[model samples]
Every structure is written in structure tokens, then in C-alpha cells.
Target: MYVIYLRKSRKDSDLEALGIDVLKRHEETLLELARARSLPIGAIYREVVSGDSIDARPEMVRLLSEVESGIWEGVLVMEVERLARGDTIDQGRVQRAFFYSNTLIVTPGKTYNPAIENDNEYFEFSLFMSRREYATIKRRMQAGRIRSVKDGYYVGNIAPYGWRRVKADDCKHFTLVPDEKENPVLKLMYDFMGNKKYGFQKTCSALTGMGIVSRSGKPFNPATVKTIISNPVNIGMLRWNYRKSQKAIVNGKIATSRPKADDYILAKGKHPGCISEDLYYRANSVNSSMTAPVKRSCRIQNPFAGIVRCSCCGRVMVRKKMSAKQPRDYLICQYAGCATVAIELDELENAVLEWIRNYIADYKVNNFESADDSEQESLRSILVNLEKEKETTLKQRGSLFDLLEQGIYTKEIFFERSTALEDKIKDFDKKIESVNADIVRLDLSKKNRSTFVPKCQELLNAWDTFDAADKNTALKNVIERIDFTKTEKNARGQRHSSFSIDVFPRISR
Candidate 1:
């Protein structure tokens, strides 16, 4: 008995001709073909959506599981991709599922038998072409999104909560605008977090107490609450790739670095904001501490208090006690004959603060280049060229394969040439990936350097006068450690002192 299968992709081209009705037509045609060949038909398996991913369509999944149970003699389909659209990985799954159950896959164009030697190459080539098509589709989709963003349209799945799409004044397009009724929740959240000085959990509880639900109108989980607070769109700006997985597309089936920050289009006042920029920034500063509530409530102590080392291994000395009656703690470095000696924590803190202040002052007066727009543009150009080169190499590889298959070259020559081509392709692919990674890193560095560097300097300059909590936060943000080492030396020997700093803003705090 044969099982007729069908699938439609997300593309309008696929949907227009091969939607539900078209699948029904294919079913009718399969029945006619079956009758003409005197083949017994048992059941039909149909998927209304694309099979770019195996898990995307439930019907296809059910069919594959049933096929593996040896419930069908064959899977008849209109085309190979209809059974498994877009990629070899997906097609391989369907091929294996049917083959393991001793079933054949019969397409209108080609009937593939897994056991045949010559047929293996054909199936492999077909699957490879499917994957290539998938990649092409992904490139096109990304390019479209880039263009759409440039055109200033919100190109996401759904508008943020408390916002609704409405026709722009031009009437040619739609824009997101604040929903009058729903926006109140945003204001409330901002007030609780900012003015009320409530912790995240407290704010969540307060919302629930007030009978207020999340954007989804359900109990708010910590993740959801965090996401709401962190989303820049609510504060009249938009940031992409905040959730890394959102950058992936099913057609590619691989994680890729999202578009750079420079690519994000900003439309100011395009929609009424739920919270002001100052309030949002203030809220972020208030929530900067990553400590849990339990730690905040308890008397927190660090076991590795002074064990951490700095660039110089001078033993971190501490003052034993203030006096005969009072207890005191002070960090110092005691390296004999070394210029470094036991200095009061207060004194050392003052020195570090002076050094940081001088550093910032020098940095400012030197007219240091923060980030130039032209640099971002240049990086984008480099990435675009690399992508173009990758595409060209893929097409050339395809042509070489065609030539090999057409007997334009002998097997020995074809094998040697193809091997070299594959090596070149792999090298180019690696280079492309490397370039993309560099671009992502550069973008992130530029963003952080611009937004946080000034803040860093400001905190450092005020470190000496900062409150205990602020001092701790500043120290945690900047210094990795202050090490101390001791050494025996001749009496009254002169000493040299040296220290180094490695600033890693991203990973430090």
C-alpha cells in the first residue's frame, strides 16, 4: 500500500500553487497514477506547512513516525522537497525514516531506492541542492529584513505589548503606536521600579496584588519580568539580538551573528514611549547589582576576601587591629626590599582613586576617539564583500559539480579538482565566519565603549568619596585583584615597584 504525502512552504510562490487545494489535486493525481499502475493505496499523509524544519509541521512528524513503524509500502509525493523542504538534514531524516521501514520514496520526477549504489549519489546531490536553496532563501530573507529596517518598518513577529500597528499618516505603511488603555501598565511598572524603589520580585508581587497581569495577561515569571524591564523599546528605543536565539531563521537552521547595532533603524517619536529615557537609565543603574535578595538580606562575607592576586605578587597585608580596644581591617602589601609596603586600606584606596582620576582626566584631555560612524560603515562593507565572495564560491562549486557529472572530465581529474575546490570552499567559509565574528565583536566593543566608558571614568573619579556600597560596586566593576608577596632582602636595600591593569569591561562585572 502507498501513502501519498504533501507539504507547502512559507513562500508565497509555494503557497499560491501548492496550498491545501493543490495538495488535494496532487492526491487525486496520485490516485490516478496508482490505479493506472494497479498499485494498492492504504492511506494519505499531508502537511499543510513547510518542512524547512522537521519539528515545524506536526503532521509530517506523525507520518515519519508511522513510516518507521512499517505501516506503509511507499511514500508518494509531488516533489522531493515537499516531503522535506529546504535542506539535506531535513531530507535525510525523511529518507532514513522511510528506508528503515523498508519503504521507497517515489516522486513524480525520480524514484529513489536507498540500497542502489548509483542512486545514492543522485539522492545526495538532490539533498545538497535542497540545502543550497535553503541557504539562498535565508540570504534573501535577511537582505529583505535589512532593507525593511532601513525603510523604518518594525520587522518583527509581534509589536511589543501596549503598542498596536496603525496606518501611518502617508497611508502607505503601518507604524506601531502606544495603545491608550494598555500603556498604563508600563507606566506603573516604571513607577514601581523607579520611584517606589522596589526590587524586581517585590514589583512583580505588587503587580499581581493589584490584579495586573503581564503583557500576556498571566502570572509574571522572573524571566518575563526581567525581559520587560530590559527591553529598550518601552523606553522609546529598540535594540535587536537581545535574545540571541531570535537572530536564527529556520531556512538557515544555524545560529548567526545578528545584524550590527548600526543597522538598527531608529524612529524617534514614531510611537509614544511607555517610559522616559532618564527613568529607564536610572532604573538600570538601580538594578546594576547582580546580588540575589538572600545575599542582600544576610550579612554577606567573602571567604576569598584577600586571596585574589593582582599583577604584582606583594603579600596583601592587613592591619591586625585599630588599637588595644578597637578592631580595624586594612589591606597592605608587604614585599621586603620592594618599594611596596604595608599601607592602610584607606590610604591605598585613596591612591587608586587618585590614579583612576588622573587616568580619566588624561583620557579626556587627549581627545580620544570613542567610535566613528565611518568605522561601522567600513566593517559593514567588509562583511558584505565577504558574503558576496562566499556566494560566488558556492555557485562556482555547483558549476564544477555539474561539469564532473556531465563527463566533461575524467574521474581522476574530477576527483583531484573537486577535492581542491572543497578545500578552498572550506577555507573561504572559515574566513567568512571569522570576519563575521570580528564584525560582531567590533560592534559590541564600540557600543559598550561609548555607553559605559564615560560612566566608568565618572565612578572611578568619585570612588574615594563614594558610599560603602558604591565603593564596592565600583571596585567590582574595575579591579580584578590587589596581590601581595613577601621576599627576604639585604638590610636597607633599595626597591622598585610596578603594577599593571587589564580593563575588561564586558567580562569584569
Candidate 2:
């Protein structure tokens, strides 16, 4: 049976702009080709994914997996280029899948049988040309977007909260227009910040009090308020590349992210702004002058800053101050959907200290130590030998140059000898690195076993004398994390309530 695959080509931007269904058209053409050839169609894989890598395209990945599993006799497409236009690795993967499975690639103009050498070579050549064409198309698209931005038009997919996009007079592009109901609300937000001297939380309160919400139809958050107040678009300036695209291989997979850029284009836009320049700048200046409450005068307050986790949800619980009527600090879960409950700050600290006290008592009873010095010494010995071998290899590599200069070795011979020695040196370095890591892990184990007890004892003895910041540092050195849970309840007047604290010490619990 034959399967049909359809993916929109980058070359079909003209068709897309003209509101033509390129994928549907390609499918119809392939179905007609199947009928002409008297082929039986088992399945159709229509790919709408707009990405370069096979890893990014789900339908292509599924198709490749099925083809590699030897399920179909042939695959039909408009062209081979539609199967793979990604990087060389993806192209080779697509080629090998069909070649090994003996699957036929049936296109309208030609049919490629991967078993034949001539057909295989022709298939490779076609893929090479397709790759070149794809690269050109990508460059042209980027240039078009840059030109659109420079022409003072709105090119982003979605407009900001207080604006709407309308087709320009030429009907080729879009321009921003102020929204009737939202524009006045945006202006009012600026007025509250600029003239009325309100902070983010107070502004959020003011908006919610007036029954005005965000674009998500929810109460305004401080981060969203900051975005609105800081954007240059409110003052009729179009900004581009505020966050630049960056890609890196993380854990052997390509990861892409957009980070804030220092330099960006802020140009005069074609549409009028909802707020005046005076109000925009004034609000920004006022917002900038105030310090955020979370900074806490550059001092640490939570001793379990990075060491506390909610057992139910695994989220880091934060310490928050209650209202003026209550006037007490409480450790609370961040989200309302979480199953965990809040506890008073003082009570939580007491429970943690008690857990540590019990841990120290248990450690004293065990009183054991790790004797890893001999293994560490053995690893160091191996490292020393590896370094000596690497130095000898480097010296050998250097002598090849002399051999070539003296006409004793031909250029090819010298290159071969030099490459061999370079590879040997690289191997030695890799061994040295592995041995070094082993030695370091041994040392850390010894330190955790021999040194952690005394430190834990000192922390308990001097707990009262240390300040909050010092105590936090001391606690971090001994504790990895504390998993807290409070699924049971007790009387309100009870001091030691029905709660559990599972301490994960760096050494032992």
C-alpha cells in the first residue's frame, strides 16, 4: 500500500498570501496520481508544522518512524523536497529510511526506487538542490520581515492589549489602531501612575476596584502592568527585537529562547498613540524610582530560601506577610490549586530546628566516617601518568614538523603521523578528566562524612547568636531541602500542631 504525505513548501508564500490552500491542493494532486497509477492509498499524513528540524515537526517524525518500520510499499508526495528540507542530518535520515526499507518515492514527475544505485544518486542530487532552494527562501522571508518593520507597519502576530490591527490602504500589510474601550483604560492606567503616584500593586488594586481587567479578562498582575507602562508603543513608537532569538544545544537537544536585547529599533509608527509622551515618560519615571518590596533592603529573610518544597506540588513555598489586621508572617503555597496549606513563619522555623536537633542526635549515635583517601590517591596516580603520556604525545606531534622540514617524511606521511599523535593526546586528556572527576567525588564524600557532623553541631550550639543571614548560610551548608506537608489539622490554640517535616540533610537525615 502507498501512503500520501503533504507539507506546505516555503516557496508557497505567494499562494498563502492569496488565500490558496496549498496543502489541500497538494493532497488532491497526489490522490489523482495514485488513481492514475492504480495505487491503493492506506493513509494520508498532512503536515501543517512550520519548523526546520524533524524534531520540531510531529507529523514528519511520525511518518519517518512508520517508513523505517517497513509498513508501506511506497510513499507519495508532490516532490521529494517536501519530505525533507531541514538540515543535512534530517535529509540523511529521510534518505536512509526509504533506502533501507526499499520503499518507492512516487512523485508526479518521477518515481525513485531506492534499491537502484542510479536512482539513489539522483534522489541525493535532488535533495541537495532542494536544500539550496530552502536556504534562499529562508533568507528572503527574513528580509521581507525586516523591510516591513522598517516601513513603520505592524508585523507582529498579535497586537498589544490597548491596540487592534487593521489592513493598511494598500491591503498588503497591517497598521495599529487604538481600541475604543481599551484605549481609555490604558490612558487611565498611565494617569494613575504618572499623576496620582501609585505603585504597581496599588495600581492593580485601583484597576480591580474600578472593575477594569487585563487582556486575559482577569485582574491585572504587577508584571502585566509593568509591560504596559514600559512599552514604547503607547507613545506611537514601534519597537522591534526587544527580545532576540537565541538557540543552544541543551542536553543533546536544540533549545530556542528569546532573551531581552540591549539594543533595539524604536521608530516612529504610522498609527497614532493612545497616550501622550508626557504621561508615558512620567509614569515610567515614577515606576523606576520606587524600589520593589521583594528586595527587602538587600537582606535575606527566608532561611530556607532554596531548600523548602511543598510535598504535594513540588513548588517552592514562599514567605508572605499577612494583612495589617493579622500582622504576622506566614509561609504559604504560591498557587490556589495546590493541596498544601499555610503555616505561621515562627512555627515553621521551630519545626525545622527541631528536625535538625534530632538529626544531630542520630548522627552522634552512628559516629561513622568515610575512608576514601586511598581511592583518591590511586586516581591521582592515574591522572599523573595520563598527563605524562599527553606531554610525550605532544612532543611526538611536534617532531613530525621537523621530519617534514628535513625532507625525511613526505607531506602525506607527516599529516598522518601528526593526526595520530593529536588523537592520542585527546584520549589521554579525556582519561585525565574522568579520573579527576572520580577523585573529586571521593573527596566530597569524605568531607560530607567527616566534616558535616562538626558543622551541624556548631550550627545547633550557636543558633541563637547568628543573625538571619548567617543562619541561612549555615543551614544551606548542611541541609539540601525540607519537604513540608500539612494534610491533618489540630485545635487553633495548639502550639506543636499536626504537621510533618521531612528533612533532607546534605550528609544524612
Top-scoring candidate (lDDT): 2
TM-score winner: 2
Q: What lDDT score belongs to each candidate, Candidate 1 first?
A: 0.61, 0.82
The 10-residue segment with the lowest total lDDT in model 2: 287-296
Q: 141, model 2: CA deviation in Å?
A: 2.3
Q: Which tens-of-lDDT digit does each residue in 252-367 have in candidate 1?
A: 55554533354445544345567888888766555521222223355423211343343344333333224444343333332212243333345445555665566567657753
Each model's Cα RMSD: 22.7, 16.9
Q: Clashes in model 2: which pairs?
A: none
Clashes of 1: 7
Model 1 per-residue lDDT at 214: 67
Judge candidate 2 at residue 54 and give its lDDT: 89
